[model samples]
Target chain A: MAFASALKCRECGREYPTDPLNVCEFCFGPLEVAYDYEAISRAISRERIQNGPLTMWRYQDLLPVDGDHAVDLQTGFTPLMKAPNLGRLLGLDHLYIKNDAVNPTNSFKDRVVSVASTKALEYEFKTLACASTGNLAGSVAAHAARAGMNAYIFIPADLERGKVVGAAIYGPTLVAINGSYDDVNRLCSELADTYPWAFVNINMRPYYAEGSKTLGYEVAEQLGWQAPAHCIVPSASGSMFTKIWKGLKEFEDLELIPKVHTHMHMTQAAGCAPIAEAYEAGVTRVRPVKPNSIAKSLAIGNPADGYYSLKTIQESDGDATIVPEDEVVAGIQMLAENEGIFTETAGGVVISGLKRLVERGAIKRDEVTVAYITGNGLKTLEAVEDTVRSVTIDPTTSSFEEQVLNA
Target chain B: MGVTVRIPAPLRRVTNDQDRVEVDAENLADMVDAMEEQFPGIKERLIDETGSLRHFVNIYVNGEDVQFLQGLETAIKASDEVSIVPAVAGG
Candidate 1:
């Protein structure tokens, strides 16, 4: 049974039927999935969730989709591992890393696409589409292939080679537009009006975004039904960061967890830090910028949820940090070297921002902090290409000893 | 050969359900004023009370976001295609 009640406008209190609509007709505000929490509270139980599949679908009661036609990729339910090594280095006592990099597509996009594709199939849509930075393209293609739907993925032309090849391997009609992600998004928005395809992030976004709340659900459940004090998340469009907080709050309201006191810190690359810039300037409006960051996945200049994310941070008493372009690779190296978790540039932005937060005394040393590692490092190898070093030796143990151990 | 203004679905009610409307104007600011003259209550939706474009709405001139160009002062010529779209988020 789907607990979602209606598609409500975030700005205006207008509600629409559960359809493939993203913007409110009256206010042009983004439409969000409003659920019948009373029903969810009655239906959901810790034991019921535990007995379900070891995936994001476990929280199906809170999600917007019915379980009848789910396009299951076995996504989500990622490991919430204790990051003792990195925590010690950062001067935090209890630190955890919600490693979403281990998802089906090696990124958290699988979670959203899983829900969106399932809804698309339920709506009887023949095609799946999105305007992706990198990760979402591959995810949409994979999910479309799984559900036997035609896929049309649009992306910026300058995206990473791994991401480009990743989507292409899934046999989707991947269109690399010669413009930024924002430009590609605008084109897709226009296309969504003309085409009948279910653009996951454009037309089918209300249901698609609900998938992110599962991340928050999984974290609290994994941590014994307790919300972390601080959650540092890398923000591109600020959707996931906001949704994660919403997830925690929903759990708290449902009496599934204690009152959520999670300080939702948002991290962004310095090259494209509109939300951080707004926070630093003490302004409510987010000014867009042309993205110039290696953390390309989090490079949405005109973030749709920028205002909502800023509001979430202020309400949570959390802070936003901007990581310099130079430190992104260093952040990636630190996590990989210490915790053996190879995360993409977005994760680097989170780690680097977390370090800055710690150094400035913003984050308490004893606070139970969780930094989200959203994507796999393998997809963005170019960001750390120079860091790849090898010991050149004649294939012999004597050469290894002489060149490495002796030297 | 006036500029072609492509109206999105949300604003089509104000445009008499017409998807595309043609108007004559020199710049985006004038174009908006012209649109207001043709279709009342649109300028308020596109622009906030502070006289800036609403954060939820984006105006693109010939496939380029007007914010990147000259914002409200962006120049528009004959046969130019202007699109008004609601901002949608995801990555």
Candidate 2:
């Protein structure tokens, strides 16, 4: 059942009908997808949700779209594994990893793109488009292909080669702007105003943002209907971070989770850690940065939801921190080595930030923690290209034994 | 009460196609008043009737967001450059 009632501004109390609108016309605040909780409680139950499809649509009551179509690549409902190995290594008793790299487009961006494209169809937009740092571009293109709509993706010219190829392979018109992700986004904003295309994170952002709620819902459900003590998520535009918090609150409000006290930590590359910087300084506003991190995907200098993300973290009693580039690479290696989960640079930020917190005792040893891995490692081979190397030896048992033992 | 206002491309008409304009104001609120004095309708684009900065419009003083410093009460130094940039999104 579709329970989304209207799109409401997050800042001001004004509301608008459920339309392809992202901002409040009056105060120009970001719009959020609002649902009638009374209707949702009557429409859905724990058993009903568990008995539904394994995809993200299982929480259709929480999302904006109907379950029949518009867009669905079987995204979400990803593996929520108990990382006993990583936990032992980090000296934490209970730790889990929300590995979203297994999505169809190989990142959590698929979750947002799916709902955005579907909402776009509802709005009768002929084209799906976005200005992305990296991951969203590929997801938008892939979903557009599946929905049989024209896709136009704009991205920074110097993004990872794999990500560029990833979007281009999906048959989208990829435009590479000659500047930072901020520059690309500025151009896309202008284009969004002029063109009739549904810029997913712009025109359809209220719905696009709702899809990330499924992550929080899935985590609690997978944990047998209880929220974790700590959760670390990578932040760029900070939309995903804020939505995940709303998702957990919605679950508790709907009685899916008895109560939620999850402390939401935010991770960022130090090169582009505006939100983290604000958080550490005990400030409310985020000062923009010129991004210069290997984690290009999470390198939005001026994150749109930066202030709100900081608010969520602070209100949840969570800490926000920045990871150096070297630590980011170490993080990717640590996760792969300990948990066998290869993740992109954003995941690197999360994993590394998690490690830093654990090391500093910010996250206690006994806390039930969850680290979100948002993208695949294949998208960022350049990050580990220098640190990870291969020693080629002759295809002989003697050479194999000697080299293997020596190393 | 003198400060430089950096306008973005879209709102260039507020400054007569000039990217940067010198405005006389002691704080952001005064600056908004000074701007509206020159350009009739551009102030609405920057702030709402309730006098809060527009969510889409970002005002930075010396590279720091005004909401962090003191909102409209943030002190405006003669050397400080105030830039009005729109919020960028997507990924």
Candidate closest to the true structure, highest TM-score: 1
lDDT of 1 by residue, A1-407 (tens): 36888989988789999988888877688999888888888888899999999999889898889865689989999999999999999999999999999998899999999999999998999999999999999999999999999999999999999999989999999999999999999999889988999999988898899899999999999999999999999999999999999999999999999899899999999999999999999998888899999999999999989999999999899989999999999999999999999999999999999999999998888888999999999999898988898778899999999999998
TM-score of each: 0.97, 0.87
Q: Write the per-residue lDDT of candidate 2 for residues A247-271, one digit (tens) a residue.
A: 9998999888887889999999888
Residue pairs clashing in model 2 are none
Error of 2 at A364 (Å): 1.9
Error at A196, model 2, angstroms: 0.5
Model 2 spans with C-alpha error above 4 angstroms: A393-407, B1-45, B48-55, B59-86
How does model 1 fare in lDDT? 0.92
